[model samples]
Target: MSDKPKIKVLVVDDEQDIVDLLKYNLEKEGYEVATANDGIKAVKVAAKFIPDVILLDIMMPHQDGVETCRQIREIPETKKAFVIFLTARSEEYSEVAAFDVGADDYITKPIKPRALMSRISALFRRESKKEQENVQVRIKDLIIDKTSYTIDKNGKILTLPKKEFELLYFLAKNPNMVFSRDELLQNIWGADVFVLARTVDVHIRKVREKIGEDYITTVKGVGYKFD
Candidate 1:
């Protein structure tokens, strides 16, 4: 028997066979798994289960993965769960869109069960490590708390996605130090993340929009630094 506690996972896909297969394999790995047949159902299930990870299918009836993920982020109960998108569309645009809407990871469909399991395991491990670091930074009226995985601006709590929060926290922690896009990717997402430099821009845009534009200064042709 494994000593680690069971991590809850929610599988959201319209295809019944895929959901069953995922649930079976995840259960065998000693994870607590739940299923939802559509995006609508996924929201309700996620609200109740509050899973540690969510395997969300992109194309689905009623809500679609992007919208569903956004809704999940809005919900305080499930907003913190790590979301991984599962889709047959391997286009870069789709992957970018997934990240734009708060997906922690994106995987093309027809993924091997073992590979999926590995990704999930890695995500959990990263989250665990993050929890161990209780660093907090305060810049002006903004407060970035790594321990709570939250940011507060002028006493207003900002509901930022995971990547956006991490990006902001990283830049803010170092104060005026400028970091290139490649450096941000390597430090934040690690080597295994298959995302382009443009993805960093997308996350930066989101962070700026939420926390105000002056928080991040773009150093044309160089990179970005926290103002």
Candidate 2:
């Protein structure tokens, strides 16, 4: 066995067969697995297990996946865990809402196990690469510390959610370089991530709201750049 610690994964769905299948296959791949049958239970299980990734179903009894994700984000213990929405719904609006509430990725149902496993592996590899590059980027008065996932603006620390912080960091990293929404989505959200380009707009609006207007400039009909 490799010396690296096993990845913890929590599979959440109301469908028992689906949950069982995911747990079995994930365990087969050497991931430490856990399962929850509904959204409410998912929150409790996630808080306790603190899994590195959560595969959440959108529709569930008592509470829905969006609500469950919101609750999980609020809980400090599980807030940073990567959330991937596993839904049958393929609507663009649903994807937007998922990203709005801190979802890291979205996947449509009837997914092949092999494809899902590949995506999961990619997520971990991306995270490992991020960990290795802990360079602190200072852009104007805003300081982005990739190591701590913190942003300091004008001597005061700004409280930003994971996605918002990531958006800011990506733009600030390449200061003055323009990034189209598609490019931002690919770079920040990862190439395998399923999200609409509008998701970048939503995150940009939120980031500008917190960080002030002057830092990020919108290039007409193109995209945005860190000013």
**Clashes found in each candidate (C-alpha, N, C closer than 3 A):** 0, 0
Quote each prediction's TM-score.
Answer: 0.92, 0.94
Model 1, span 130-220: residue lDDT tens:
6676578999898898766788888888767878888888899888999999999877776656777899999998788878888899999
Off by over 4 Å in 2: none
Note the Cα lDDT for every prediction shown.
0.87, 0.88
Per-residue CA lDDT of model 2 for 7-64, tens digit only, reads 8999999999899889999999899999999988988998899999999998899898
- Displacement of the residue 190 alpha carbon in candidate 2, Å: 1.6
**Which candidate leads in lDDT?**
2
Give the worst 10-residue stretch by lDDT in candidate 1: 186-195
